[model samples]
Target: MAAAAAAPVWSVDPRTGKRREQVAVEATAAEVDTAVRAAHAARPALADRAVRAALLRRAADLLDAAGERVIEAADAETALGPGRLTGELARTTYQLRSFADSVDEGAFLDVRIDHADPALAPPRPDLRRYKIPLGTVAVYAASNFPLAFSVPGGDTASALAAGCPVVIKAHPDHPATSELCAALLRRAAADVGLPDGVIGLVHGFQAGLDLVRHPQVRAAGFTGSVRGGRALHDAAAARPHPIPFHGELGSLNPVVVTESAAAERAEAIGAGLAGAMTLGTGQFCVKPGLVLAPEGEAGDRLLTALTAAVSDTEAGVLLDHRMRDAFLDGVRTRAALPGVQAPVTPGAGGEHTVSAGFLTLAAAALAEDGTHDLLLEECFGPVTVLARYTDEAEVAAVLARLPGNLTATLQLGADESAGRDGAGRGARLLADATALAGRVVVNGWPTGVAVAPAQHHGGPYPATTSTATSVGTTAAERWLRPVAYQDTPPALLPPELREDNPLGLPRRVDGRAEHA
Candidate 1:
């Protein structure tokens, strides 16, 4: 018999440039099968709304209890500061609790009903509709946001909230944190008297591929680079029973400042832009990669202030050397392009650090056919591009060429009013911004994403695999599918869809919504 191959998981500390901990061995194909089957088996337990809510709350409590240890491990592996990691842990726990509330409310099911009507020319039969879980979800972890976007992150929380089991493929960068989180979640499931495999953790590249290919995995969620997300998306599609793949690939989230707005808030906007671009070393997927500003005194003042702010900014280390190398390479590529000038040239600050910076280019350059088109893509670090526009027409044209983003911001002047009349200059700009991004900000930056009910963290195409979100309360919607019960008996129908409304769920009856 042939011997099995070994996959060792190691934690590399970015700050020290050394491997600090050996987390675990990667899961083999047989182990992957075991995890998936266990998750599939646990789907029955998840059917109980009370059980689901309890499990989520237990997980949140356990995470809260392990607060200090979790934060320290995450910071040790990711090199994200203790303060930042602590804040991320808070957000992570808050998201878990939020999902618990969502599961308890049961509104994510979206139940509806219509009685039989035989009097009309073509009367419809009795019909009812409500969403159900799609089964096990394979969640791919992100390198950044170790706690919030990894192991016990939004994807995992949303899946569990939707009554779907999650098998998380831990990001290679933070294996220790992943293991710790998985243990806490498993303990929570046990405390709630749920199945052990409600949350599974696997390490290594092969396990991730196995997860997507497994027939038991009915859906998947990912937050990562375009290259990786695209590959996984294709693999999931090629499966016999293709599942929903909600992959949040990166974005070049663009911003536009009206000439007058820049004039009025030059210093404030400049400092704010500097802060946004460098937030988390610009690791956020929604970091503004491009900005459209007019060419005049206003533009110059903004650029000068922005340059000063960026220069004043201290050097910072990235997640890892691999990310640092990529950031440097991307900056070099952009700087070499025609009409691209490095106003704040971003590159390696030292053997271990990356400096914040920006690039300048004429807005017309973006309208050109070939080279400038690359500027529309994300650079993935503390770097941004300033697209200088000569006129309003040029600004509009530049915005049109950009791809969809998770967010698009338009800093408007005092005179600029967004009204339906279409007579105002910025009013017309609203439509353009709306067409480009999922979340439109009029006078703010895109770095700080809130965890709220109305939040939308996904956008068109490359921004995400679908229009569904991977954050906030509505994120669970991605892991669900609607089923219609036509001419079905009352007892045979789901409690939420039955005439009695035993579950006390909100539903629409006879084309009218009923609160009870």
Candidate 2:
């Protein structure tokens, strides 16, 4: 018997709904195994912090050097526009360099030590603890962020920073861009005296399944739809030795507008909402999908402004035809629901593009959860759902029905902002927002996510699978596991845990902080 021919992977242009080119063939099961094993074999090279840091910096330089070519390819396949793709590339390179700096800092190791205490009840023995790389990580690239969340993205950079080599399951939407970025990363590894196996890329849906199931792949990171992410999560858990599956799934990212806030600047709020919801064709994971607004003259003014802004906005192409169809279907379903009125109809535009729009409904309908529950789900295009509420209790009722989200935003009035007459109400709302989301916004939109140390990009179920973040310095922590050494011979101990503290890493000794 002979092997079957490998399937071809084509790069399609979203704008024209045509295949741009055939980038590569789908990786077979054997190929996926080879990629995983190769990455696993190269893990030792990343164990050295200095070499790992150099590799990251070199990768960033190479990416920046090829910025024009990279952006061109990304824009062609994704139809995201040159301007947006350029910024995404910049963010990707910045992330690589930032992870290199984090590697040098070495705080992610999280070393801790405690000397023997003879006076203690149980006579505690000497112990030293620190984190070690889990092993080779499998990264599932995302469709929306071809660069920042795809190849050479945060997951890959952070895994390498934690001394784990990576094998990326390239996103079907951007295979060519993935191949280009993977080549640069491999070149970087070789330049820094590491093996080309330090980075690996594979294409196809089945390849993703094979990569996750490979024994050598110790952990996995993913970004995609709830259905897709949940399926992968289940696969990882079903493995004989279940691996940690950290997935950024779906999010509704609801927004709440107090009556006073709407009264203060309904027009401004409406215009801002229009911009945020339609940004990136409302493809952002943090895009505000549902908003709770009050029912009154002020709210009507807000709706009027939003209607004008969205009507004036032009239609745009999504990442793919499937997403365009899904967006249209979602809009149609929600629009046809009882009491749901389309202020501006959102559906297919010019056969290839989709126009932006919003749906209006009574908050009371969403309070107890009936057929209107569909509105709470995320619709991945330029559309939003506005629920008109009669009172704060109605607002609370609607909010309580919402699922876990990446962010929860509150539009506050002047009195609320200053903690004046409505201080108690503001405090209560803030607390509620905090309880519902990982990141809470006050008087602002949830469209942009900053790559900062203090940023928390993960939240409760559906938003992410684990408590860990997929961004920031702490993201590296996901690929590491802590190990404690107990009363080992002095000479046999690793330098980081040795009594002499040869590495000079920041650690806690005898319950006291020791700075390098």
Candidate 3:
């Protein structure tokens, strides 16, 4: 019997809906297994913190050296423009260096020690605890930001920082970019005296499934749609030895415009909303999809400003044809709903691009669950739904019905901002936002996500499969597990756990923080 040939993976241009080139063949199950095993084999090479840190820095340097070529390749497949791709590449390299710094600092290990107390009524033995890497990780690349969220993204960087080898499942939208970045990462590993298998790449739908179920793959990180992330999360759970699945699924990043806020800066708020919702063609996961604006003259003024801004903006190409079709269908369906009005209709611009716009409906309609509930769901394009509310009760009702989000924003007025209203209306709204999202914004939009230690890029339920973030310095925590050694001999202790601090790692000794 002859083995079936693997299907070819092509790099397609979303701008013209044409195949740019054949990047590689879809990996078969055997090939996926090979990649995972290879990654697993390279685990020991990343055990040294210095080596891991060096590898990350080298990877960032290599990516920077190839910035022009990398950006060109990503732009060709994603249609995201050279400027956006350049920024994405810069963010990607910055994330790599940040994780490298995290590796060198070694705070992520979380070392703790409790000395033996022989005089106590119930004697206690010496116990030392610290985190260790969870072997190889399977990273599912995203389709939007081909550089920052795809090949050399935060997930891969964080996993490597945690001392885990990575096998990235390339997004179908940008296979060439993935291949190029993977090669650079492998070269960096080799330059640091680590095995090339420290970084792995595979392309295929089934290959993604195979990678998650592989016994050697201890954990996985994902960034994609709700349906796809949920399916993979289920697959990881169904495994006999289930692994941790950190998936950034979806969010209807909601924004609320207080009456006073609209009165104070209706034009500014509307213009900002237009820019935020249409940025990157509204492909950002944190794009404000739903907004609650007060009804009356001020809200009307805001709407007028929004309409002008969106109308003046040009139509843009999406990442792929499927997303374009989905966006158009979503707009059409939402527009057809009763009581919904498209202040400026959003739909296909040319055969390849889509225009940006917004839809309006009464907040009362969304207060109770029904057909209008569809309005609360995320539409991944340059469109946002504006729901007009008559009072605070209507605002609460509409907000209560929203699903979990990565970010929730509140536009407050001067009095609210200063907490001088005496009624604490702003406090209540801020509290409500905190309950519904991981990151809450005040008088700002949720379009751009910063890569910093304090950033929280995940939220409840459908927003993410786990509480762990897919961005920032703490993201590496997802790939580690704590281990405790009880009454172990000094000679047997790891350098980080020794009585005499050797590695100069930050640790907690006898319930007190000790800096080496």
Candidate 4:
């Protein structure tokens, strides 16, 4: 018999369990440094707002025109369906436009000028300050949102918008798609006369490490596991001249269904959670991995509804083999815990798919034992562990025990949800929930991240490193730092900081702040 052609290098597709393509991994430290230098050299021209906005608009146009091609490429490489890919592409384009709009708004410049006035008692000096680009950014693409968080994702877009060149370390899971998107971005940059080297990508773990450690890299942006994010964060911190590392590490996003809310509409909440937990196979950083529903008949009812809803949905394939194996392993680990029951045991729905389901554990077991704490950690798959609380006190205690998260949700009824009951207790509960997360959802699932200026898509601790800014429009702030210039001549001052303000941007002039 003739020899079979080496089984066409295995690559899993999330939508359909099949091989898509064989990705080539070839790059060395020298090549990476060359790319970074090219990007660094090309930074100044691309830093202009008009130039960057035009590049972003060109990218959005390309995404719109060739969206289908991009979607197909992503779906083939990731096993994600067309429907999901389509939505992700839209989000990616929307994000590009959002950044472009932010550039036009000029608010991201954040200009503040304390003009010289020796006449005052304190004799204030000409302290003119504004944000400046951090040279080059090293972005680590995510496996789950290949397009939206990948080569052409928010990190690259935001970095470019902030006038910093980007060097992306593509995720190995979907390298082909990453390459394709990189090509499109390069073409877009070329079209607008922006340097093609403004954006570069590399594949492989070693390459990622090298990129992070590259001396010229001014700052970093990451969206991945806590382990990976922390490693990069530590590396950046340990560097000779340490740079800021803005990472959205990981989160066991928790949802609390107050006793009254569960009693009012258990079924609706259960069904909604099923969708959230399994959306993209529970790969989102904002997925409600931990749910706190008060115990008693109401909690049981919510559990039952959740079980039925999750059981009905077919198990979807995770991002890659590593994630799939981890999900299965996590589920098994949690199930082995005492007082934990998988009312709906997740199973392999298809060749590469795993079913969606929930596991129930008593609040006491989680509180009393350290083993159960593992159940609270993120499994990164279509599995949620519903911790049943016997009463409000137990719920509060468990809430207190939770690590900081990207989002904390509370499902409340008309009376309780209003936060203005006759007894004035509702307001207290609302305030308490808001304090626990970066984004607090009153009655909705936390999975859907809306692209808006007001959104704060970050949280405390392991959820994110520094809590001063968010990962939305505010994410640009991370790549730029404020520098104050004092007692400088008009000729020496930056055009934006001069008394006449040629750019017509908002600034604090004289003693009063004004916007033009």
Candidate 5:
């Protein structure tokens, strides 16, 4: 990125409340244009499958070599401990290598072919279909996960794997860490004989808007708040040549505890819930924000256990002062509601530290939409709300009121309708759970997201823009579109879509599927 140097951007340490490093100056519109154009010019060079895979692998290697320095910068800016940051770096590199392996597999292309069928009513012609990469892509870094969701995050990794050059808009909270990771990726590209501009980086808020509006960009991927993500999504849509925007905005991640499960293992559920809620100072996007449990002896037991565990957790620092203020403001607004109980008040304890907390309220309070509506919004800190339900109907009603979430978990008993279906109350609960969430967890938490083939980190509406995932192997599909050829000469067709199937890819032909 061309540094304007007009104004300096400082990286502040959240723990000590002081500036750590001057990363880079903000990028102007002209600089943004230059960076994006450079990325667009390098698309063909990055399109080779072997080269892309090697580039990603090299990036993983470079990150591993610079792990100590990167972790130190991330810790200084975000105040996430060295241990957690190390694990996050591991996950980030693992994600890059996983995408590299997917590129090597070649199945992500989703190629198909069909010979001409004269016996049909309309006399069909030969057709071949395969997914192709959109041109240049814009990636918006997330603030919560500095390494995994920032410069070398999943969005950037998957886009590169899909043959799309990326122009990253670094999040302001960790600009230093973003710069470090960006340098590593560029070095990896250079090592793999790829262009330096294969991955472009820009800093500043308006530069992000300029990136999505740039005509050369064909798609975008974002991970952030609902307000910010929605604005960018709308901007991408409003463009003359509108692009596909895949954004994981926000989620409440509501969880329901069955009476049987609570009775069987109330202490276990409570302990797990406390740990997940306070993980990363409750800054994780998938942290559980809402809990619905029956108001009974079992529920009381779980609450007692959860409260004890939460109270024992020491306060931790937020990512920045603005986030700390927003978290406290959210807590205060919710606590001011009538009949709301704060087991551990989540308020700003010091100049930069915040305490973990949980709120309690009757489930019926959400049935009517008023100030109680705040309960549905995501509070991005170490806090959660427990809604006590009088009966299963109340739980169902509460679930209906919730927005789409990344995950919804159910803690069930060992034999609670595990096999029986006719009168097994589990079916109804499962049905309700699947309606509101993408991944329904059974007797587990949603804090740790696994990066695998079947994993989907998205849901309806507010959770994400579309059903597509921002993680896992299928994520590359978001940066790709399908094109079908009809009766084209084999020599003129791309090798992957040729009649001879030179690439050895599995393709559907003559109404029959082939997988190899």
Candidate 6:
């Protein structure tokens, strides 16, 4: 009998349990361009609305079909419980379908046309405008969201739908899962008669930098720590021809609980905060990292509930060893600071596990000196800091000092603004805090990121470089730029913007809105 082939040995990292393997790495600048060129060459045909939508739907189908298997692989690699991983898979698929729906709606094309009016002074000419695809996109798959933000995630899906080819710099934290997902996406592209290069995945730190620096890579999407994202952002900016780098970096999502709300339901708020902080081991960028509460009984009651809730909670593994180390070190630093009290110390529960807990300090201490201000930094794990204020004005002061964030939540009592007097105060406070964040939430947790039309997922600097966008149907706008064609014959216009517009899409004609 012929000798049996040797099976590839994949060792799993205990921190995230991500299976490790030695895959062929893309080595040269020329190889990087080849990948980008392949995508660019395939762009024209894939730009068709029907073609893009079908491919997106097919990708969704593949993910749906392999949902359980993908979840199993992710769990085996990351140790994220099946329940959460399964939900992540569902969210990831929903995101794909969401982009497909956006394409089907066709509003993303944003067509505008102005016909010639020679009678006007200076002999006005016909002008028509439509969004054109950016050439090729480089996507940096995120570790926290291996499924949703990796290979087949928003960046890849949105870029592909925009007719911009994508080259993914796979997040090393979950390379194995990234490989599987990328293969499935490539197969989907082939099924739709599109080039396999429509999606590409490369491993290694060097390979990622090469992909980002490749002359043909027109733009990139990143989700990671502030340090990592900033480095890539600078590289993209410093290139000979700078490109757009849409990145969602660090955030300390703060939640404000009014005195009235705390008085009515301290325990409920504590329990809810615990769930949000510890969800997926505090891996979400939107995790509530800070809490601002009023003083006296309400604050005491909140502390009591928070302490009890955190103490009872068990430790959970982070996405990787680096994160685990940061979490432990953060707890140690905060717990050691003067005037800082951890009613519930979120210490290391196991070798690779840490508990969800909180640290409390007087607002005066934070205001007095920046020494204890380390509390303001994000711990990047299942931990939160509660800052107690003596008055509403103090709370407002602290809110003013807060850095840009992805989300800022307000926990209001039912009658928080029922009367004119209360409404004025609440409105002013909410407005001030809202100005400091990208998305403002009222009476709900910021952890649940809903995929909806009005969602603004991006935030101020550090939260995201571009304040105007986040990962949504709106994200497609980033991969496209409007080109105005002047004095063009109807025959020369793109089919979608022609006078007889066969697609029946909404468009601006002769300075007025029209359909079909």
For this target, which candidate reaches the highest lDDT against the unseen true structure? 3
Ranking by lDDT: 3, 2, 5, 1, 4, 6
Question: TM-score of predicted model 4?
Answer: 0.95
lDDT (0 to 1) per candidate: 0.90, 0.92, 0.94, 0.82, 0.92, 0.81
Write the residue-wise lDDT of candidate 3 on 1-516 in tens digits.
998888999999899999989999999998999999899999998999999999989999999999999989999999899998888888999999999998888899999999999988799899999999999999999999888887789999999999999999999999999999999999999898999888999999999999999999999999999999999999999999999999999999999999999999999999999999999999999999999999999999999999999999899999999999999999999999999999999999999999999999999999987889789888999999999999999999988988899999999999999998888999999999999999999999998899999999999878999999988999999999999999999999999899998999999999999887
lDDT of 4 by residue, 313-423 (tens): 876777876777788888888888888888899756777778887888887776654778897677888888888888667777777777888888888877876755665
- lDDT per residue for candidate 1 within 340-393, as digits (tens), equals 999888999988889989999899989776888878899888999998999888
In model 1, where is the ten-residue run with the lowest total lDDT? 414-423
How much is 227 displaced in model 4, in angstroms? 1.2
Task: Show the colliding residue pairs in model 3.
Answer: none
Instruction: Please give, for residues 1-516, the per-residue lDDT of candidate 5 as tens digits.
Output: 974456678899998788887889888899899999999999989878999999999999999999999999999999999999999999999999999999987888988777898999999899988999998999999999998888999999999999999999999999999999999999999999999888999998889999999999999999999999999999999999888999999999999998888989999999999999999999999999999987999999999999999999999999998899899999999999999999778787777899998999999998777779999999999999999998888898889999999999988877764835345767778888899999899889999999999999999879999899988979999999999999998789998887677777777777687766
Structural similarity to truth (TM-score) of each candidate:
0.98, 0.99, 0.99, 0.95, 0.97, 0.94
The C-alpha RMSD in Å for every predicted model, in order, reads 1.4, 1.0, 0.9, 3.6, 2.0, 3.8
lDDT of 1: 0.90
How many collisions per candidate?
Answer: 0, 0, 0, 8, 0, 1
Q: What is the lDDT of residue 485 in candidate 3?
A: 99
- Per-residue alpha-carbon lDDT of candidate 2 for residues 1-516, written as tens digits (9 for 90 to 100): 988889999999899889989999999999999999999899888889999999999999999999999999999889888998888888888888889998888888889999889899999999989999999999999999999999989999999999999999999999999999999999999898999888999999999999999999999999999999999999999999999999999999999998889999999999999999999888899999999998999999999999999998899989999999899889999999999999899988778899999999999999976789899999999999999999889878887887888999999888887788444778888888887888999999998888878888999898999989988888999999999999988988888898877777888888888888
